[model samples]
Target chain A: AVAMPAIAQSMPEVKWRMTSSFPKSLDTIFGAAEVFAKAVSEATDGKFQIQVFAAGELVPGLQALDAVQNGTVEMCHSASYYYVGKDPTYALGTAVPFGLNARMINAWFYHGGGLEVLNEFYKKSGIYMLPGGNTGTQMGGWFRKEIKTVDDIKGLKMRIAGIAGQVLAKLGAVPQQIAGGDIYPALEKGTIDAAEWVGPYDDEKLGFQKVARYYYYPGFWEGCAALNFFFNDAKWNELPPIYRSVLTSAAARANVDMQASYDAKNPGAVKRLVASGAQLRPFPQEVMEACYKAANEIYEEISATNADFKKIYDHMRAFRNDEYLWFQVAEYTYDNFMIRARARG
Target chain B: AVAMPAIAQSMPEVKWRMTSSFPKSLDTIFGAAEVFAKAVSEATDGKFQIQVFAAGELVPGLQALDAVQNGTVEMCHSASYYYVGKDPTYALGTAVPFGLNARMINAWFYHGGGLEVLNEFYKKSGIYMLPGGNTGTQMGGWFRKEIKTVDDIKGLKMRIAGIAGQVLAKLGAVPQQIAGGDIYPALEKGTIDAAEWVGPYDDEKLGFQKVARYYYYPGFWEGCAALNFFFNDAKWNELPPIYRSVLTSAAARANVDMQASYDAKNPGAVKRLVASGAQLRPFPQEVMEACYKAANEIYEEISATNADFKKIYDHMRAFRNDEYLWFQVAEYTYDNFMIRARARG
Candidate 1:
């Protein structure tokens, strides 16, 4: 027999506020938090409601981590890399250059001991993290010129971030970390030669096509960028078991929904971009190869000095190696043939 | 401000029973149902409990859909394709030959209108469906001898089920659908020339490797097989909104956890299978090409007579086409490079 809700009963209604690292205009990203909140509210019979505050509504986007840590906000939907200044390990929780893609990251976190390892790191920060959403593999960036070879990037000035920016700097590119809103103008005024934003869906909204005609893909730096719903430790522990379950499931649903929205919407965006005369390009083999070399070097150097970084990095690398092998044999082979076959038909 | 849960209160208690199409021995498949039940109970603070019954304990495995539909059981966890006898449209809820893989399937269902379309179809059967789990990509199967060309499949006997079996029949192979436990013995006794179960993890447990030396990959027929959780319409609607939300999130979590478990476990299973003298091989390109051709033809023939099948198939086909194109430029390219690089290292 199923449990029926007791009617005419009184229970305390709970409400909370969440600060998002993204503005409402980027619905796909910010919308995941909204989706989580609404589902949680509905699941709790309207007893649990979380009001979402856009970036700068309550605190600047980058400071979301601080807000949650100090209890300025109970929770946040934000990217992990925004707090890399605290520890380089923060970047691994999100995405790293040449790292796992969206599916692989999910596999790692949920199955390959990644969640436990990362949570141990988060425990020190006085918060708990749950996967909020993911943007599937991102595009390389919009460029004003085609990069024909490795040399093309040597003197290039580009806006990139986190470990990726560090990797590019080693390859002789001057990496500028600019705020998202300022990227288009930087590329337009020749202040920067290129700027990497998210993939087609988000990049199109930023008007990158208007300034940069060449669009390179497989942003090796961000194969997949994962966003998290973070809860303060004491507040999280105080919640009833049922509400905790709601939060867990709601966040997981949001995780799947966000990526699906991106995947569904991105194809149309790419089509529109091409129609607008945007050229799609793959980063030249020479450049990809050089970046690959630099990324590994950077990993090796960081692993030498940071114990926590080394610990998680080593585990992730091994897990990633195994994932790549398995996917190549099954997923890759099937996809490669089918894409070509469908095109032929 | 964050609201805390009020203590010293009583809530109603509920219990449920889940009928599963899989036996207890197959933990990964049957275990997902257990996982969902346990999560629900815990989330409800013991106010809800779901006792699980293995196939045949209550009803035969294939009868799971009937049990749920009739309210003989409140819910059931099984593959949608198992009930294809009820309607060919049912197969679309699981997998079809050369169809979307695991990640793409998630995208289609959650965001590409697959869920809405399929749920409408399910409403006729008196149940609501939620994605329960996925076996990422299954292996082609175990072969007693090497298959070098399409011709080798002409007279072979294989134990493969669903639409894939029909496609194999078109290619001149004799198809047999046997219970999982019986396949290994049949393959060993020369009753069947080949047998396809799941991937390495489950296949190894069944000792398929000991009897068959050639293990082929990219089960083109089942690029990914999705299992589903079905709740009886009457019983489902009677639950409180909070309970419904619990089920939604719980099922979603199970959906993700199942795939993660397989992905995490399969690599080790693969290595062990090779150690046991199982020769790993990809199905010859010629065989794959022939199967692909047959699959498309079968879809066309079925679409002509089955309106429900045609409607969903067309949406899925268009969605699959777009997904393949987007994945090619980014996911595929990056994977193609990284896999080779990792192997080389």
Candidate 2:
């Protein structure tokens, strides 16, 4: 009903496809892609629309990055670590064993020059990335039997992802890479001894509790698993500046909403899980220490050969140290007090 | 370069003014308003422009809500707690004594029905609100002297905000509400014995370190102070749907970026402050416990009379309890381990 501004009158109508690395059932993760798309559409008044396809619709989840890189898709939502086979450096883009947590990663990416460093590496592959989602500290995978010591890992076969699998292999465990849909059957049929998908919410969705009795805590490999939206560099550069800003803002909203969804949903899921006869356990200190040591050994070994990996790894580690120093003093202290008070009640 | 879509061709150009309750010098908090405005302009191709004014440009900081409500400005950026004088229910929109931290509040607002509940109350005052910024767990304050027990608080005059002041008054401490710029002089001239601001980064700017040698931490009263963008309900309803979505996305970006900026900057600021001879101290357990007790007593009294306050307060407490239970398991243990390892190194 109002007259149009000159700039708005010249805007272009655009449409694109987005493939997700998650299933539609795990709404928290997959839903983030939808959130991004919806925001873009709403902000542009449907002038720009993105169609979202769940994993396997266009390609397998693990192949999401390849699809974008090869021009099979213009953009896709997936974890950077899923492409570690192409470059170990990819793990740093998502997370690494004993890497920064959700808050720390966000701080590093947004203000600590992490995005610049990461984009420099990603440019080599013709991909542009934006943080799309995050699952706060995930639970340790579901295990058929308890893990109390490093020796327990010596003969275990576990389904894991990315660099974490390599870290486990160093400790004598046989690591298996399985798709999300296949993890349950693999564990049920004795193909795998343990498997981890995500935290209580997603883990509950996969029915892992029915098959595995011992559900563990502190997914060490993924202190926080951040997902990304990968845009084909050529396609990204072709967009009008206004659309680019809209996309960036949309991705940022999805990033915060995903974590908030997980934090709010996980509490109730954990309660339901425990009531379903799932035995909750924390990794023994001995196992955690050994894994921590082993993880560092692998990082140093990789850093010696790969310049990109070494550069990002060193930067992230430095940032992580400072974040911990500050967190211990105030954030941690306050949370610790609240936790104790809740327990007392 | 490209032809405009039909919807874009009819879009209207709109300009509005925004007043902020913070000065320009406190960039992390005040700058969030700038960030939101910039994003909106960029996304709309300058068709929708918002000009942001710092406190006192349009109205004094404390009058931000009044300016928006009475149509002096279309919108204003402020903390909901700043208007507790209008109604105690205002405190729940930002935070309350010993309430949820930054992450928890985001989770509660976005997913646990917090935004809906708070907006129901906000609508009564002709305002529409969206979370715009957050300061992660803040420092307690700058104190002229160490407080060892409840006795030390008996005659102390502290500059505090909102409901925290009432909680402290119950403990025999005198509470003073002073504007941000005046705090340094108040502490220096013995007008107030202590003052609490956001955190290390903001506190360092206020030169509180020069006035008070003792810097205490874990500001229990304001665990995480969230800021909001308040729009005049009539103006909000008149916006094009596209403009509303663009504004919402922009505010969300500002919300996350502010916290990220704080987390990234505070560590360096803390190091600098300590190097300059600021003594870091934690509140004694006895005093913390006394404050905690007093805070709950005050909440109970408020809930007994205010139906809106009781409804939201009870919901937040229940959510807070569940959140702590989950946090202690994975988030806390992971952070605690990382903190100790950092210490050992």
lDDT (CA) per prediction: 0.88, 0.90
Error of 2 at B245 (Å): 0.7
Q: What's the fnat for candidate 2, on a 0 to 1 scale?
A: 0.77
Distance (Å) between predicted and true CA of A122, model 2?
0.5
lDDT of 1: 0.88
Error of 1 at A237 (Å): 1.6
Chain B TM-score in each of the candidates: 0.96, 0.97
Q: How would you encode candidate 2's per-residue C-alpha lDDT over B162-227 as one tens digit per residue?
A: 799888898898999788889999999999999998888988887898889899878988778899
- Measured with C-alpha atoms, the lDDT of residue B90 in candidate 1 is 96
Among all windows of 10 consecutive residues in model 1 chain B, the one with the lowest summed lDDT is B2-11
Clashing pairs in 1: none
